[model samples]
Target: MDVAGIARIATEMTDFSTKEAVGIAVLKKAIDINAAGALALIEVIPDNSQSAPNLPLNLGRNINTIA
Candidate 1:
């Protein structure tokens, strides 16, 4: 192939590589943001386990299904 054709192909390949890199970087950022948000949400959930300590320990241990 001529020099011009080779140059064009190289330029196209470079552009494709750059676009792919940018896409991957953006996806990583989005995933990081989502993970941070999920952790924040999880942290805010009230700890109900300690709040009901007054109930009997065996209250929920067994189920009576003979009724």
Candidate 2:
């Protein structure tokens, strides 16, 4: 079989898609953020970086270290 055919088989079995795997990979990477020191990001999310409003930061301090 040709190289393309082999790739198709591989994608269909284990990858996201046999056709749109590239797009899926891109999206997964874009949204696959770490749960450490990162807040939940939403689309069209308000950019609080421009103002010092009275918004309460929900972040916690990891004080279990022996520093």
Candidate 3:
């Protein structure tokens, strides 16, 4: 899903009495978005970048850790 869609879902999932659901949803969505963005960045890297292959995996790990 796109960032806007994720944001909308996060907003809709929120309840005034309990913030945990909303917080978790938002955090997960943010991590997903970040991972996607990191992959995109890796794709756009110049062919000379030798470490490009590991970028997405590292980013995924970092984002997962956050979630």
Backbone clash tally (model 1): 0
lDDT of 2: 0.61
| TM accuracy, model 1 | 0.73
Pairs that clash in candidate 1: none
Off by over 4 Å in 3: 1-17, 49-67
Per-model CA lDDT versus the true structure: 0.91, 0.61, 0.75
Instruction: Residues 5-65, candidate 2: write the lDDT tens digits.
Output: 9998887777545447788777777766553225555434665643435655542324658
Where's the lowest-lDDT run of ten residues in candidate 1?
46-55
Higher-scoring candidate on lDDT, 1 or 2: 1
**Per-model TM values vs. the true structure:** 0.73, 0.24, 0.44
| lDDT by residue for model 3 (37-62), tens | 99999989866336567565445333
Which has the greatest lDDT? 1
Name the candidate, 1 or 2, with the larger TM-score value.
1
Clashes of each: 0, 0, 0
